[model samples]
Target: MEEIFDECWNSKGIQVFVKRDDLIHPIISGNKWRKLKNYIQTFSLNEHSGILSFGGAYSNHLFALAFVGHSLRIPTVGIVRGEELIITSNPYLNQMNDWGMRLHFVARSLYRDKEIPSEYENYLCIPEGGYGSQAIDGMDNLVHELPSCDAIYCAIGTGATAIGIARATSVLVTGILTLNNRAEIEDHLKDFPAANLKLDDKYIFGKYAKSNADLETFCRDFYEKHQIAIEPIYTGRMFYALVDHIKNGHIAPDSKLVAIHTGGIK
Candidate 1:
């Protein structure tokens, strides 16, 4: 974890630190590495034909999995969400291709099923956003590296990271939802203990993968001031919510708060 020194945090009377899990690797950085670690380690190439996962056009999970497949020399297949992406050439998809991940695009309707299609059923299916039990187990181990604090905060995409951290730590875990799917996220976390878990959806900006001028300005100014790259998709929103919470007296004064930089900045 890296300590963030800024006037905003200081003025709020809160000590804030960010877990630099993003620094773990250049390609498979942050919680991506942590979440995929156990799955990759235990995966047997001989036992299964290949690994199949799901994601969107710019999914960090897909990017990281492509790298993992390249490094491990395993055949990886990505079931893309949007069929339109199949005819389009983009950096993310291009990189996945270069990494030897076979791309299969499906309609948004079928993608909502959240299951690997029957034809690819032979391959080991990893869930979208890497939110399976293995990922939770991996992230639970990540919590061991964190220092004790009054509160822990992270951006919630699939809620796997937040749920994993919440289950492993005694401190209150505040998950800032980047998407406007509070009910779905709540259902996902139903099985987990809620003793000190909180979900905040006030700073989604518009919706998942959508941003506005205010968010862009904040991200630009924040990067200039702190030299920490934060994308509006995840980290930026979490930080914005943190600042807002602190300013509004939601977060207690002088509390040591740890904000997890879950990466995917690029």
Candidate 2:
């Protein structure tokens, strides 16, 4: 896996590094691999009929799981959180379909009640963004494999990896929230035992998967300058917030900040 340190080096004064978890496992790179590691290991491919998970149309978790299941010769199902619609030959969805993942659509209203759904009986109910206890269990290995650093930063969607990372290390964990659903995220993290996890909701462009011109420009220029592809969903926001924090003197010069590159470079 190529670790593009160039993106972090542009801070002028701040010394930043990115833990390229996105490159750890090819198709299953980043947090999705961490979140699904245990789940994948526990069952034999022949034991279960298929693996089922939830996601939005463009979800990296869904894409990763589809690839993993297909490679392992396991049937997969995706409960997409939207109204049923025809899927075109877009790169991401096309790849998932090529991998033979059965895509199912649910009403956005029904998706909000995911936890108590009666449809989850036979399927392994992996939540959206791969949150919950299983994901935290898998993410426990993320920071432990890295060198000691002053702070570890990542973008927060479901808040599972942040909680797990903070719990697994003494380093300060700062999460940039991509969702306006901070209070809801906080409520979800109540059971997790992470000591130094902090959430910043200000960097969220508007809502999940949404971005503004500043972010778009930053992503384009950052990729052009460093040749590292970053999608707006997670890594882009983390990169933006990290640079802004350094520029604003929020990060100390002596601090060794490591950002988790949970990659989905679309």
In the range 1-68, model 1's lDDT, one tens digit per residue, is: 78887776687678988888778888788889888888888889678878889998998998999999
Q: Model 2: which residue pairs collide?
A: none
Which one is best on TM-score?
A: 1
Cα lDDT listed for each candidate: 0.85, 0.79
> Compared to the true structure, candidate 2 yields what TM-score?
0.89
Q: lDDT tens string, model 2, 56-166?
A: 878889999999888888788887777764456357777788899887778899887764335546666677878878888887777767777788889898888888888
After TM-score superposition, the amount by which residue 58's alpha carbon in candidate 1 deviates from its true location, in angstroms, is 0.4
| TM-score of each prediction | 0.95, 0.89
Error of 2 at 5 (Å): 7.5
